[model samples]
Target: MTEDTSWVGPAMQQRVPWVKAVGITFGDVTARRVVAHLPDDPQLHNHVGGPHAAMIFGLGETASGAVGLAAFGSVMDRATPLVVSSEIAYHRLARGPLTAVAELTRPAEEVLAELAGGQRPEFTVTVGISDTDARETTRMVVRWTLRPNR
Candidate 1:
């Protein structure tokens, strides 16, 4: 199972018990576009009672990674990739429901084609985390070495 589609996405959640336990959802998983869902849980609270930094970090990181997965059309058949590094900044306090969007950087289509045909592509997945109120809480940049499946 992979996180590129609904069936596979939810199915693979079992592999990451911690993430699933925290109520993170892989809503849209496709190349060039990535989106994720997060519930406003109390466990994600900070000293001030807003979402904790780690929670925001997790949401932003996952969203960025998902974008790379989506850039490949389907992550169902690819090898599990690891995050080499992540650098993010919080613009404001995160509140309410949050949505993360990752738009592919570089030549997305060409890179995906190469990856599907047996190539390892290193790229940056830029993502933004926002709330249902249409407010952005953070901007994240995730860099990874993507090894896709044929």
Candidate 2:
């Protein structure tokens, strides 16, 4: 199914403006992936004068969460998506504008099947943070759990 992600950024900023403080904005969303951008700004600088790690983590999670909703919204109407856990590895200091991209690792059918059986299911999305030069700066695996809204 096709979904319109054009409103994602504005809607997200309205829901969580703190994310906007760190310069997070939705870049693109497609059936295969969701991408977010974090501009290179001094406001996001660390004590050492580099991008803060926490902000980077937030950017990744935001992107992944957007992907989750777009990819599974139909089945997730009565379910709530929660971030169960995440693992991130920073390869180098972020020195430029950053882009976080999240893509599904398993087929959508598999995840929906579990939900159809009235079982809470978990899905993982791998978000890669890349610099303006397209160099990988960090990698994060965010595990999300979908539970009945009750």
Candidate 3:
């Protein structure tokens, strides 16, 4: 039987306290997308009293990583994920809590097929950070690759 890994998000925060320190909250996880939030708080506030840019980046990365794991966990059993590359675009300022949602640009099945074929697959995931009003404040694309665990 396969072990349930639904606790991945919270467990990761527990294992890496820094993530929790930045006020990252793990949310919905599915084969389609992964969601996380950066709550509004002093710890994550910037000079203008908005979420720090670094915090936004961190939240986006975390959300993308979760989506990758959810989509390719089995194929990654013998490998580990690495952030090969990433790009972020800041659209506007976030004045309150922000939500980050990440999902693959392509179909999960196609990416999995490449992995199943013994090819090291790389997928691009797009994360959109939105404010409490659901307006996009930041957008990021994270390219992930799996490398054999040594």
Best by lDDT: 2
- Write down the RMSD of all candidates, one decimal each: 4.0, 1.7, 2.5
lDDT, ranked from best to worst = 2, 3, 1
lDDT of each: 0.71, 0.84, 0.83
Per-residue C-alpha lDDT of model 1 across residues 32-137, encoded as one tens digit per residue: 6667878888777888877788888887776776565455435546745667678798888878778888766887667667667777766787889997687998
Residue lDDT tens for model 3, 32-97: 688898888877788988888988898899889888877777766677878999999999988798
Q: Per-residue lDDT of 4-28 in model 2, one digit per residue for the tens?
A: 7666667667777787677687877
- Per-residue error for 76 in candidate 1, Å, reads 7.3
What local lDDT does model 3 show for residue 5?
52
User: Candidate 2: misplaced stretches above 4 Å?
Assistant: none
Error of 3 at 119 (Å): 2.2
TM for every model, in the order presented, reads 0.77, 0.90, 0.87
Per-residue lDDT of 138 in model 1? 90
RMSD of 3: 2.5
Candidate 2 local distance difference test against the native: 0.84
Looking at model 1, the pairs that clash are: 30-70, 31-70, 31-71, 32-71
